[model samples]
Target: MARFFAAIGLLNLVIFSTSFLAAEEEVMTNSWHVIFKRDVDHQTAHDVANRNGFLMIMPMLGSKREYHFMHPQVKSNRKKRSIRHTKNLKLDPLIATAVQQAGYKRSKRGFKPLKSLLDEEKPIESINAFPPKKGSNEEDPLFDKEWYIKNTGQAGGVPGLDLNAEAAWAKGYTGKNITTAIMDDGVDYMHPDLFDNFNAEASFDFSSNDNFPYPRYTDDWFNSHGTRCAGEIAAKRNNGICGVGVAYNSKIAGLRMLDQPYMTDLIEASSMSHRPDLIDIYSASWGPTDDGKTVDGPRNATMRAIVKGVNEGRNGLGSIYVWASGDGGPSDDCNCDGYAASMWTISINSATNDGRTASYDESCSSTLASTFSNGKPGYKDAGVATTDLYGKCTTKHSGTSAAAPEAAGVFALALEANRKLTWRDVQHLTVLTSKRNHLEDPTAHHQWTMNGAGLEFNHLFGYGVLDAGDMVDLAKDWKTVPERFHCTAGTVKGVYKFDSKNALKLQIDTDGCRGKKNQVNYLEHVQSFITLNSTRRGDVTIYLTSPMNTTSLILSRRPNDDDNKDGFNKWPFMTTHSWAENPRGKWILFVTFSSESEEFQSGNLFEWTLMLHGTQKSPYTSQTSPLIHNTKSKLALVKRQHERAAEFQF
Candidate 1:
């Protein structure tokens, strides 16, 4: 049965209604005054930026489209906001309190304001002040227009979501009919490589209500950030300039959710754009900060809206929201932000390459970590190559913000590979199809440090940094069950085989939470997470017991998304198996064999099995996965080893 909302079409979701929101339209006009696009009963929020208080900084939202950036005052000092007795600085009480709670010390609070309040050091630096063209001194070709794809990973900076990754994923798609939206800063509307895939029709600016989202004279000019981010995710390859994007065939749309004071405004606009026929995913690389036990600012309003949209879903439009964690990492303690912790959207953390481990990483204390870089360690070894802003990208940009766009670009490719993949499916596949699991395997060069968050969905790397080949392959066989998964790289090994009539079934079904102390999946399984845990304490594990020696399992429960843990994916727990935290005894396992196994290979017998971790209960499907797919996608798989392996083979 299909239940639909009548008053507001399919997406008639009730966003947080403020007592004054209905009247906001009449009061909020522009140019001089501002409006409260949403309501604030008695909790959570601020009215508006002080008049002339609006400052244009880097889009908290990130991008990788071929950006034409300004010197963007790399002078920013990301810190915990605080209220202190100082002649030079001042802080908003609520935001400062939030920062303190988020864990940042009061003194650690401060960022170069976009504009000068009183002649203090500001964030914007004149273009002429740009560091002398010190490019080419390094090895990355992304900085050299003269170089072709050579500058990519192999050249030390892997071009994100570019041609090679796309070829395998873009089999039948051109991204024509599909439009992917990014919730970031502004786009480089003038970039040649991005214009083709750019969808102005599907784009909007939440940062500014004036309809114009391009960069301005404000401290955050050089609209290139959004463009660069977009380019990395979906730039038109084969255009013959420098390089390509992940979803070269998919249409790219932008929603300027950053660079402004009112995230509520951005959220409202994002909600209104929830049309079934218009967009696909909304990618954002911005999030709340991570403090050991403090919150420096209010939760993101746009993020709040994203949660609503996730719960309410789009106009059956199949759109998902993607966000980035913060970058105060290598600090040994991860302090990612709010959106990444929120279950409403999929959060992305950053990884470095070219030889160094994933940089831009947060302390292990954060969630949703991963890797994606213009150039890092291993580039010299992996032979991977990429295109980049070509500006002075010498410094490593490690933050959740950097990580968000990486995931978003990969997601764009997923959409290009299969336009039908809904928000839920996208998140599911990403977690299941990630590549970090192999690092834990005996055969791989397991540099445990590269594995952020420690294990699976730890605060560091969310579901392990991405793997392009695996993601593309996942998209190819996503809708179908997988059989005989070869040592395929980058994705979970859920290779399904089809019967003559095309009936479908999975090869793995392991319970999600086997044991528990609280909401967290612990230092291990956290890497695979896209959603936060029910509880925030103790521990939870989702592993299959190798046959021969198996017994009782553990099921853990904790607090909901309300406020248990810091930096957790805020949504409910979801699993590949339809089984819930408690899979009833109705579960079983079977094993069949075949002669051959390949991508298009046929005639392979399969194995089906189930193992309960905790207790038994009806409707065991993961609370999270179902919400995204509107259904359950879990099963069981066992190899000749009789090893109770997972479906999301990494």
Candidate 2:
């Protein structure tokens, strides 16, 4: 809501060494960030902040445009809008000048009214914005959206939810017009398969509002993850297509909410507008853990907006919002906490392709038990079948990050089936139709204890895994009816319900432990059933760990600050260019051009800090450094082969 202005200043571009050589003249050997710093002649910094035109145009390999940021010297117009950038190349230079005029001093300071060159030779003003063009070396076959949709070359073909089958059989629905808003880094809007499905009218980067998200393949971060997620949500039905989507015909809308600082406000703003009938489903593959933990912190702006939308969403035209439960759990005191599954409004859990649960899946370990998304490893809840942006078919999708969208795709199908169903109704029906693990209970332990039954509501796996067919059937007879129930731990003596007359107090006691390790035994079981789908390497072996005994879970990323002038640092003590190389686990190492020097600067903020992560062997390390000034700076995670990226980590 705050306006900003422009002020011209002297410009200086900072360059960084690249793994690939730049075009000679534009190269900066030991520098990062091709910064352009200029000064405004007479205009004050606040002036530029007001118009929100300030742009800092250094080349980014990922999405084409950037959410331009004001040079630190500019007025305090730090809201996301000020940092907006666009993919419309024609307008890049003009916007660049307006951008420079806003802050950077590119040339003589007595600036004249800038005329857009877009009208003459290049027309960037009216150019249809999209993600950025790929760099020459960024040869990711995943750029071909159709390839992934087919699940071609993937680890294994992705499996459709049985519930999807049920819905298809009954409703004959394929999500023709329902719109899904994917909240993540910009998606490949122009991919042939995705282009047909994109609802351009509904798409916008609330983070910038003025520009299209820069989606390029050259930057590893800007790879096809978003496209893959969208494919899972609503890839077109077999037109001889490679992959299948939950809602084959749903309209997919791309909203760039991630890849920025303080995305909450932008996300909230997007939800507050006109309830476009087209957007009946808002699928956010990003969020913080509600459990007040470090990695997953308190509710951010986007979350508050979602909650608001759920309660009073868009003039009562509330959209179904689905979230991915995290893969962080199965660890000590790790609960499926916050935004993703924080409230009844949000659905949470992991994916399972073949019914086999893995050791890393973040289970429906919340107050409400939800369905287990199909992971790849059958019988072992590993991952849902998915296409990698890089065009690889993953036999076992490895993260809840993958599972959430798959579920969202299913939710979209339900919307397509019943046009009148509201979010609350959709959630209830999902619960009702979910297949309880206890449907074939083997014994008392697996008796679907706290889980909800069509007959009752349970906590672990809310009502159990959602069935697409059941949802379709319910949509046929849709109404605004919601599940009304409470959990009394059914025969499990440890979970007790208090009388309404007293204050709200939660007292968990393991006093019923008959054996010395009964408490430990129980936790291990929970971890096994739920958190198994996260990483592929680890076995579900809980070592009698609890939050009390746990130290800290630290995350690491590639080094962003090579200067080391500021305390800015990467996560793990050591990083490597080669996967097999042993890291010092001492000094931070980044993706330098090579062994030319011990330290080298990365091209930019996002580029340098990417490709880093922590391991189960060391979930966290004591050493830490963000921007010395504040937390919430852009942080990337280097990923291990078996484990995918974390949504909350960024």
Candidate 3:
């Protein structure tokens, strides 16, 4: 690990853009981050930064005191500073110097060290796009071509393993009154099939800070990805253009954030919370690079945004977040992704048209369910058909990226069936209505394990393909789940060192969960925060076993990942494999290094923490403030209508 670090500098604040805007006077624009020592008063820190130079201040979402400050670019007179571009200047040295000159002394309890610094970290994004097959020029043309919607055994697909969207539409649960925000590149809302269902008020362009979240002229390569994804959710029905969406009556919006040159954590947070009150679900088809390497997740601000949205969005019912597990089947594991592995989000994987798992799916316990997307490689099966940019239609959408929106669309139908369902209720319905043993692909794994709750789940298929009809039907009579309950095993502070060929095992007993104020019998999601030192991160694999003997392979070896630039730094590994498992008894975590790998011979498990999320037997008033929107989603519709009315009068 030390050698790897010497080879690659720390993965900290990275400057991707060549240009930064600065004004002559009154500070037009500046980008810098400050993390004060613990116990620093918020007002004092803000005043200090302002006195130095930072004028625009915003609190970092996750941290209690960390603040991100920016200076505006004024057009008029400005005093000159040596640092002209925010990207070039490292603010830490200047801030430290300024504080020292001001005779600011460190707190007695605070150790002597540099606590504040610039936040410049950037995250990588990989998009999913497959070659599209041209559709026929006929009425309701592409409907028959969309095997993912209704297989009919077309192109080697199974007859009934599709999402059953046709049956869902037959029941009149077409996602009415539901709005989904696609957090990706951009959506071609003007496309004929998407224009009618587009919701402008629910959309925003975080990259450009504009109201219209459409693809710009600079980047055509990535623009169509979001549009195709949106088409899978709410393309206009009977449009005579493209295939119908799973939830044809649902409203779709776009939050353009990923197409920019630099994808900073701050920008991602803005996108994650864009009009959460108006949008029911935030669909994300993009994540860290799927190169069978990089292990990364949302930074502080983004993490805070996700938590905030799930707790407060939808007028307090909570916003539903849908994430693609990943497309790195050959090597990567979805557990490495913080977003998909989070308990607050629904992680979805892709299945082929024939009901088989996609070849590129990264199997992990974090995945909750599967949905139809593209077909297996070297096979004649067809991929999904949906609208694209330039006012056209295509059938090339594939990958888990394509599968997540399909799941989101199903949830939209469920939401339409029962508007009062909370985010947790949506997850329950997903687990309940998902079908097992539906895929017919010969190459895919077919193993199924019956969980303690009598529900069967497979890592490859994630409780099997989503059943749109069944989900909506269940939603019709779904009772709101009891309030969420959590239990924690205090931090393990010891460093257990080990060499190759030996496994490190640690156990914790719940004692019928007496420690928890609320008794928990079943589990929803389990998370482990681990800090480790490994010679080769790619050679490490971790597993968690529940008392029921269900073992989840949470961290798989990634051969391409050689550097631990961040050294595990309390990284979290989560699993949904324990759903409905007895929360009492013993839970074990096993960490191991591959003996077969001669290079990775040694490592140390520095620290670990365990957390459990589920429900109690009886309902109690939730400590979390109820976020129920008194007016509900209808408020957004009314606003949209008013905007259209004002536009028409002019």
Candidate 4:
């Protein structure tokens, strides 16, 4: 009789727990956010919501006047009904706006795990062991395989084709006193390799609406992305777990915004601006679908949050944002990805262990630098070694996803060396210090070009692979760059037509806002805001030539972009190819249609405007040989030699 009573008690507890969870899920699913007007008092808003059978949850994060509310009478699965209720809420005079809370999938930039490629099922003894080399201090078993950190060519990789992390480590700059936030699915804070460095105070879960950003587990371990990325930045050193991080002493914060049914602008904004005062760097590896056609970017709220973060975060030093240049390969152009192309973010591309462009790398002028990812097949232990989900470790992290965090780790080291570096200062350091290692474009579409300012740049590799040692050395003595200014050089307003056979060329001439407060002499980022309509948008290619005769292919042909109705509406096609160049003469633009479909297509250029962003005075005046005067002639000679060599290859 006693045993029977105990079983009944257990049954009742299970029933109660199930009922409570169901209620909580119902509340979460039926939630809607309503932005109240400034004039509406909280008491009045509460009374109105109560009269309408709504219960207040709380205020939305990163929003001033937005409040979350739920209607008990509304069914959780009735999305259309929930949306209708929000529409009705918008009709109230006290409410400024309303939106139903929902979830959407944010694509992880890393390649999905393949059973054939992954060695997760293999026993520890079955994997080939790489003994640590001489003078190595890392005791972690996987350190020998981390070629990107200190490449010794353990896996058929080229020696010294690495980020030179050891050099920075030698200088005792291991990202101390800095925090980097990984904005992804969620982080395994409990993982032994990362637990020591995880900053719980700066972490949050917008998806689950909780303070704990722990990843929700699954059978297939699909949510290991954030954990891997975090491990790349802050996994503990000499932990006897996994390989050491590039910034092993830096703090890691997990902002869990992805891994939901659908993504909302509020979630994105909250993640981007979360604890900006505490989180110095925001590392993001996810973006719009890389299906070779999608053109998407941050929404209005997210855009505002990013702008606010960079302008006001980190005690006005500006929050640093590192982004992954998309992995859409040769068919897609990253110029369409606004997040990567934005002047506010540092877009990073990927190179392989062999120092070649990754097979899936997308070429664009906006990519700021390159980092090592994974090598080709048949190379032993070529993938990145980092911590995985559930206290495990992985040797298969690959993609621009892996590359971005490494760049973030490098930036963290720089920050530790100099805490006063602003967002723009980091970009300047990257352009000035990044090296032209052995990275090459296998497609041969983009060759190394020497700008008028003598800076070498490539569409595939940007300025070049990051050199942590050089970056830190420069950061230690780096002065804040001159205050940035924007100048509108010229605008050409007219409709010009072009067909497949004949290309359309337009020119704009101006003094670059000379004799004004916003005068720009040295160039930084150049933007060509264009509006056009094409019969087949995918066939259109746009190129811009700076006054210095340096040409930038701002927009390449996207064969998969078949949309003909939308075209481009004042799309800001940007390029860094003209960095440090003068913008005071005639600028030329060429728009042509190239297609193999045998379909004759035409396009109309509705308007063209040239915008220049730089400083009135030279930013390099503090350094020796300002404007790279000593290298100009040498660079020009190399350019001519390269052109001659290309002539024979073609």
Candidate 5:
């Protein structure tokens, strides 16, 4: 095959010349990220980093005048004196954007330790011979192998599929004063079931810049992936040592920022704005390399620290982040992962203790739900029993990195049963208490459709699974879901082409912005953005649809993306499968190409807009009872309370 594509083009030019000489020796000895000019204050950007010999080093946590300096005679053989000190700190008129830091690889969506029964030395009461059931006062012993917190189907799973988390721990909602950070790679927080629910002042260690986010030990423990996603979110109940978490009195922050030798955007904007006012659920489970040809995401100060941690973290009642919708199964396609197709990250995905799906999940439409992980290959005790590294224990934490800390421990038991739940009221109580229980999609491509408002989605398990006692019983009567707006609705602009048998189809029409200040009736996250170019950008795909027609396969088909040079530029591409669906008139989109040998697929698009998001009132009329009678049988009792809040069945 032409000498096997010239030995895969000389092993991709020696792995791109050893990752461009280790990113030019870590940008000639690290630390730069400047950005000053908001009237450059902080002691005039600390006296212009001590008049340029630079040293400063801190100021960036959650940005806004950014900082991080360091110079000291630029090392690794001074790459042209670190490109002339980043071109004289961007020709400093009080600098406004400097950079230098460059690493980016991420990956860790768990799963590589197969050959199971966790290499057997049995004990944990000989792998579950029944016993610990009644009232289940869990003296840990791997809490009866945690069948994702109460599945009861022992090992073959499927009994009550799971995570009703003991009916949200029988309503007391154990996540007291919720915290949950665990960004990844360094948490073992002295693991005695995560040492008294570890929140060492909201932990730090942006990879050894330290304040002990622990886990560095080696011999293949491989930094126990943020201590098994911090024991699946705060492991410390009656802690006889191993299982029990999913908000077992939640608090666990340990943002070690991945065992670093790379990954940057100021270390993912300082582990997503570090203590977002004491971290109420960051979670992350690494991203980008699900490898169906890496389309990556989040750059530029980790997209302004996830839009300043969802518009001014926690104090603004926002910071919920959560991610990991990528173990790239079906040949990778988490909307080509821009941080799990970010609408400010919630993403999740990965069902299994019998709810199916997880063979490394990743089927996109911007995920939104699904939890539990470990299953499929031979299934014995399936996997994911938490805490490891030194204070050891593990039923081998499987992927979607153990399902985004089990949906950040069921959103820390719905933020401890609603300590005023807002990051869009925990994404509208995870799309009105996520449920379609027995997940599915066992290769039946992604089934459960239903959108134009009668909810039920699924591009590989979304609007489903995660039901910590029905999302803490609809986050204790949620009501905090109005305000968010968005609009845009239509655009299109210029260049359009097609291939693999024509197929381009576009149309817009919108009214979602009708008389506007960001109007948008009902739909929660639509996005679309785009910009395209293709010719084999993983044989394109796209889709969209809804003016209540609901199609939405918003970008899929990344069969090992054969990048034909930087394709999608604007690239937003989100979709909650048109959530409440009423974004005014006609909207179709298509774009297709999943190549069936048309000799040279194709693409182009160039632009598209759409946007929409929701809430101009009626989040089901703020959970009803405004003395009901708004006629037409109160709009059929708010469409049966929006189909029992989309089947959460209150």
Candidate 6:
């Protein structure tokens, strides 16, 4: 029998006695959440909860087994109920017992009360200075200021250290029929430069629970983050006022979920899933706190949404998600962020105008590629020129925040080039086409090494900067990659300690090939799960080496991070530096406490696991056939190229 919370009699409200509280008595509300066995229905779960002493129970949105329930009276000694309150009252175990007696096993469970996951995320602000105008007469007035799109020695930017968007644009691939959703605070859809391609039908304001995804505060400096991001991807081409976007003809929608007073996991999930059918690319510039000490990512609902989007969106072509690597500077690692590390998202970092890593870019092995953005540390830099709040234009748009949307715009051009590309196909093309050593001076000292497949990779710079022309060129002829294969190594369990003078090492061996035909000769991502205890996490440095001797400095010591709390509790660090490596040999993980400060003590490595995700050596038929669609697309593309060539003829 299914148990529906709505069927419960009027969902009775029980008020407890307030006199039992102190003079400064706090309102203690008690509730419990549980995920019953999959076989159990809503009615049965309701009965189970009612029999277990829950006074009022309600199901969580989108989940039938999962529910939220309230007790008749306060049992704990706190002003408000918390995870501790639930534990102290033994609510989790009690609910577990009740569900078990009801003949259903709990496949998923949670004890902590659901609260706002939004805490700390600062937008990367563009520097105050603007670049000089060097665009030709036919170009947008501010086009020369967009060093990230057209780096032609303007504003001290190294020539050619850009996305090569102009080259793609010159070929008439200006992001037609592509729609990217800016999953940020909000976007100024009416801005003159953005209005032409604004996707109002796909827009939604989850922050305000409205249909229009517009900034709440039109004049506020912070409200412009989304607009700036949108401008980077789809600002109108040759608009005369502001600079052009990477995909100037592409459409963009704003899914307003961030910048609210409180953002729960459900809101974020909704934002991520909103109009997945319509939004081809989901561009997000925000994530967990980047304070160098915090480690977090999307919660349960949001994770489900991410998986769903990639699996079901775009009629199974898969939605392309572009995420900013982070702005936590040298101290932070992008691996700590779940969204950036996920295979579903293309994590992007930032390079400065001078062809160097941006000062605020967080280094990590998970970063796939990067693009030019703003200034570097100790150097005056010119930021990206883009649309701002209140129908204004600004020359200051910087950070990985700006880098993500720029990548999104470039991707739109790729989608236009060939509409048959899947999410994985896009990543494969990026890795194959991204440039290396384009930076005038890479700030990170790690030298680039050839992975097992002979692809150059650097921990700080990712595969390298995204080459718009190259990606589009490759994407046009790109066949979908072979079937994806995932393999996990044995888990390492035990407490171990080490320091700079003595590094602790562990090795796990693997057979690169899984089945007879599905050998993993090339790599897409390498994930390392580490559960350890440390007195000072900032003191720890980790290195992961592939069988090919390609080393990734996974963790770098942060001088400012002195938090003594538990460090890296079952955190998964990912790396793309091992691309194309044969996974057949032993992989080594090196953990060392490098800080000499006495404040840092030795740590314990309780357990670790290594998971590899990559493509098979042999091609296989995919569940979805893109070839039929590509056939038509190829014809259209050839026609366009020929027409473009004729137009260019003198």
Evaluated with lDDT, which candidate comes out highest?
A: 4
Clashing residue pairs in all predictions, respectively, total 127, 122, 17, 6, 0, 6
Candidate 6 residue-wise lDDT, 77-196, digit = tens: 334445443553345443442211000010000011123111222223322123324462344667777878777777776787889887888778999999999988789887777877
In candidate 5, how many Å is residue 408 off? Answer: 14
**Candidate 6, run of 10 with poorest lDDT:** 101-110
Q: Give the candidate order by descending lDDT.
A: 4, 5, 6, 3, 2, 1
- Cα deviation of 210 in candidate 2 (Å)? 3.6
TM-score of 5: 0.33
**TM-scores across all candidates?**
0.50, 0.49, 0.76, 0.86, 0.33, 0.76
Off by over 4 Å in 2: 1-161, 166-170, 218-222, 261-278, 289-304, 312-315, 332-336, 364-397, 437-447, 450-460, 482-650
Candidate 5 lowest-lDDT run of ten = 14-23
lDDT of each: 0.36, 0.37, 0.68, 0.79, 0.74, 0.68
RMSD of 6: 12.1
- Compared with the true structure, the alpha-carbon lDDT of candidate 6 equals 0.68
For candidate 3, give the lDDT of residue 4: 24
Give me the displacement of residue 519 in model 3, in angstroms. 3.3
Give lDDT tens digits, candidate 3, residues 1-650.
Answer: 33223112211211111011111122222344555555355676677566655643455544545555555552222233325434222354333221110000101100012221112111112111222234533345678877878877777767777888877888889999899999987898877778889999989886666788888753223466788889999987654666789998999999987775445666677778778778999999887667666666776556667767767788778789999888887478888776688777899988887666666778888899998767655553266778877677766567787899999999999999899988888887787668774654355444787664445788777777888887777677656777666667446778887768678998877644554554565578887778787777777889888887888888887777675434465676888877755666778889987535566467788777776767654111211112113222211222233344335321
Sum up the clashes in candidate 2.
Answer: 122
lDDT tens readout by residue for model 4, 1-650? 33233323432322222111011122225667778886455566676678667876545545547776777787644335466677778887778887776433357786575463344422133121332343545578788989999888767788898999899999999999899999998999988778879999999997777889999887556778899899999987775677889999999999998887656666787788889889999999988778777766665556667776777788888899999998898888888887888777899999998888887788888888999789766776678888887777788788899999999999999999899999888998888778788888776778888887778999899999999988888788777878777777888888899998899999998788888877887788987877888898879999999888999999898898887776877777789999877788889999998788888898899988787888776666554322234354332333344344335421
Q: Cα miss at 526, model 5 (Å)?
A: 15
RMSD of each: 17.2, 20.8, 14.6, 12.3, 22.5, 12.1
> Which runs of model 4 end up more than 4 angstroms from their true locations?
1-33, 39-63, 67-83, 91-93, 99-105, 113-138, 623-650
Positional deviation of 558 in candidate 6, in angstroms? 2.2
- Over 239-356, each residue of candidate 2 has an lDDT whose tens digit, in order, gives 3333456676788777765654333332343442324445666765544432212222112223434444554443454657776655444331123233443332354554333333
